[model samples]
Target: MTTLMTVLGIAVFAVGLLISIAWHELGHLSTAKLFGIRVPQYMVGFGPTVFSRKKGDTEYGVKAIPMGGYIRMIGMFPPGDDGRITARASSPFRSMIEDARSAAFEELQPGDEERLFYTRKPWKRVIVMFAGPFMNLVLAVLLFLGVLMGFGIRAQTTTVGSVSDCVISQSAASAGKTACGKGDPASPAKKAGLRAGDRITGFDGRPVTDWDTLQNDIRRTTGPATITVDRRGGDVTLNADLIRNQVAKSDGHGGYVDGQYVSAGFLGFTPAAGIVKQGFGDSVGQMGSMVHATVGSLVNLPERIPALWRSAFDGAPRQPDSPMGVVGAARVGGEVFSLDIPPEQRIATMLMLVAGFNLSLFLFNMLPLLPLDGGHIAGALWEAVKRNLARVFRRPDPGPFDVAKMMPVAYVVAGIFLSFTVLVLIADVVNPVKIT
Candidate 1:
């Protein structure tokens, strides 16, 4: 039964992945055609085509490998200064440029002379290139909002789940000394007569509704403090002196890190969990935080390669924040389905995973580096800047930016990306990150 569920989860993720790829390519195809650029093919995958059909001027198809997708636009790069696709050259770098230039015009038809992508206005070209990643961002936002506002997310509530018998320092806890020793002091919650099932309504004199704010308030207060709770249809106030003690550090997301310790006022009680639906503002805020975190991850990606190598080849444990590929994500999806949780929660988690992946795709593709969509956008923008500056200086209008010249750099970037992807794949297979 577990195996079947795992297979089902993987199948579901595969479908979602295909949809995301097709959706991303559709953005490029639609925008290119709208801008009068001739797009010859819109493919949802790489390698040999499994199925394809010509529609109007474009051939739409799916390939065997569901890894990535692309749309082939005619004349993506302008011809050389001599007004023709230059012949193959002696140097490998020069050959790369010529090959790219030739491929861009390979589908040149009679009417395509004026319909080339490079012939479009720089702004239009920017839109054509930016559309793909923007679509992913839009999809990610919608998915996240659906899961957050529609399905609701599991959150901590004001109700107490359990009260500690004695206060245990985080250092002691991290050392595996969870049980209270004879010298341990009675916990504030236990001493103040706070019990499980007590729904705390206020801390000090301020009204407490959410666990995050309440936890922060608890950490900030020391000495005598007042806690009001709704106990059996009656409001009860308990008084206790909050003490400074070592505790687990906050993850900044209403959660505590297990092994990381910090000195703060200790609460010695666990908050109960409940499903909470977020409003539009809250949902948007959550997405903003997620985007910020994703950007940080991308910025730190280069530093993670060494860790990935160790995990893949040196038998090192995979770090929780290690880079994950499609394989790792799919494995996580399988585990999500197999977990002993409500069906809705499991589905919500899976959707969140897909949403996060889409978000990552948007940010990754937006990098201003060659071979990625953002590279073309950056090139177009640079061309626009150069032309505007020339106009201001009363200089001759420069021709379209020769993107073909950067083909060598694009190839180098592509090679690096491919190598990193393979390393991530190996790490994912040999030492996968498991959420249990």
Candidate 2:
């Protein structure tokens, strides 16, 4: 039964991925047509076509590979320096440029001279290229908002789940010495008569509504303190001496980091957890933090390649922060279904996974590198800058920027991306990251 559920989860993710790819391509097709560019094909996948249909001037199709999709716009590059689209060159780099220029005009029609992509103003070209990634960004934001406002997130509450009987050093706790022994001092919570299921209401005369703020308040004080709790529907205040002790450090999200200890005031109680829905402002703030974190991950991607290589071949443990390919993501989706959680939680997690993937697509495509949507946008912007400078200097029009010249660089970037993807695939299969 678990295996079946896992397979079902993977299938669901695959469908969502295909939809995302198709949606991305639709943005390109619509904006290109809107700008009067002739788009000959709108494909949702790569490799051999499994299904296709001709609608107007566009042939819509789905290919065998479910990785990515593209739209073919006619005359994407301008003619060569010799004013000929069929020009041949001897040098390898020049040949790559000429080849790209030729492919851009391969579907040229009788009236396509006015509809070529390169013939449009630089601003229009920029819009056509930027629309695709922007679509992914929009989808990501909507999905994230849905998950946040609809399903809510599991978070720590002010209620106590467990209380320690006696104080012990973090090192001793790590070594399986958690049980209270002879001569052990009673913990502050225990001495103050704090018990499980008691809801913490106030600390030092200040109201406590959340666990994180309460935790920070506790850590900052070390001497005499008062804790107010709601017991049997009555408010009870207890007095105790908060001792300075070695405790595990928090991970900044109401969770503690393993093997990381610091000297702080110890409260000796674990907070309860519950799903709490967030308001629009809070959800937006969380989304902003996610975007910042995702950008940071992309920036530090190169530094993680060596670790990925070791994990793929040396039987090393996969780091939680390691980049994951589509395969790894699908496996995680499957695991989400197999876990013994409530149905709503599983669905929420799966939706969050898809949302994160869409967000990654948006950020990844925005990179100003060749073969990516951002590269074309950058090229168009540069052309606009050059043309404006020429107009200011009272010189002849410089014409459209020959983006085909960058084909060689694009090929190199594509190769690097492919190799990295394969490495991630190997690591994912060998030592996948586990949620548990």
Task: Return the top candidate by TM-score.
Answer: 1
What's the lDDT for all of these models?
0.91, 0.91
Model 1 / residue 137 / CA error / Å: 0.8
Supply the TM-score for candidate 2: 0.90
lDDT of 1 by residue, 1-436 (tens): 9999999998899898999999998899889888888888999989999999999999999999999999999999998888879666899998899989998888678988889999999999999999999999889999999999999898898999999999888788778897888999999989999999999999999998788889999999888999999999999999978999998899877677778888889878988999988778778888988999899999999998888899999999898888999999999999999899999999999999999999999999999988999999999999999999999999999978898899999999999999999999999999998885
Give residue 99's error in model 2 in angstroms: 1.1
Cα deviation of 303 in candidate 1 (Å)? 2.4
TM-score of candidate 1 versus the correct structure, residues matched by position: 0.91
| Predicted candidate 2 versus true structure: per-residue lDDT over 1-436, tens digit per residue | 9999899889989998998898888889999999999989999889999999999999999999999999999999999878899748899998889999999999788999999999999999999999999999999999899999999989888899999999998978898997899999889998889999999999998999878889999999898899999988999999878999998898775578899999999878888899978779778988988999999999999999999999999988898888999999999999998889999999999989999999999999999888999999999999999999999999999999999999999999999999999999999999887776
- Using all chains and alpha carbons, the TM-scores for the candidates as numbered come to 0.91, 0.90
Ten residues in a row with the worst lDDT in model 2? 247-256
| Candidate 1 off by > 4 Å | 167-185, 204-206, 220-226, 232-252, 256-267
